[model samples]
Target: MERGNRRNALWLKQVIVLDSSLLIAFKIKNDSHHERANALMKQVVSERFGKPSITSYIFDETVTGIFVKSKSLRLAVEYGNELLASLETLEVSEEAFREAWKIFSEQRNRRLSFTDSSTLAVMKIHDIGRIATFDEDFGNIEGINAIGLV
Candidate 1:
């Protein structure tokens, strides 16, 4: 019984998927969601929780968008680099893709964007039950749980 409990504890500490909104919010200091995202990130990075992970696609999407919108290139680059460094990169797998496709098909009328679909895919594949996103669309996604601030 003790061994089983220990195993469950260990499994619960595994990686949790990080979303692009979280990174973007964390990087842009003035954004309304910045503080919320930062607080959530701190918990993820703390000793008791699992490490933060995101797909490479999310990485590119966030870093590019953040930097592009920033007036100060240097500051944007610095924040973007720091945000990227804090995360563990996960490569999207075939299984993830299939699951995302299924979600998309089921919600075809909703018109879920590719970005959110990909994130949902990664979450389903990795058994990640929570996502740190500021977008409500993520919450609408079935199967994948979203941790949006809304």
Candidate 2:
């Protein structure tokens, strides 16, 4: 499918990849984008954006970020457990990791992190065309729509 068509199809199916930035914002009340994240999550739960999926890399990043920022291991574990129970978590295969490495090496201008590259790889491998993210880096990527960014 064409990129636009794929995005439209994804929208109709309510399928989107979840990004660590969005997760962090939603979990951290003091975050600058907390309110926006909450609103987006509410829409997500209502199926306005379809079902959200996350890769293992994103889960690690989110839980680590929460713990680092909150300094509360309990809160981090709680959030992690909630996510494990509520969201569909995709594993990053070895193929995806190689693809991510390629993307990371090929990018000279964009500063996408290794985990972000892994997310992109996972999305491509899974045929997912949309992502819910607060990170602006995703805006520069083609063939995929980045939602929840202002």
Number of colliding residue pairs in each model: 0, 2
Off by over 4 Å in 2: 1-14
Q: Model 2: per-residue lDDT, tens digit, 1-150?
A: 999988865653557888989999999999999999999998877766668888999999999999999999999999999999999888999999999999998998899999999999988877778899999999967888999878
| Tens digit per residue, CA lDDT, model 1, 1-150 | 599886755553476677777888887888888889888877867833466677877877787768776767687677657766776777767777777677777775576667667777776655666676787777665555566556
Residue pairs in candidate 2 whose N, alpha carbon or C atoms collide under 3 angstroms? 14-50, 14-51
Candidate 2 matches the true fold with a TM-score of 0.90
Score each candidate by Cα lDDT.
0.71, 0.89
Q: What does the lDDT come to for candidate 2?
A: 0.89
Candidate 2, run of 10 with poorest lDDT: 6-15
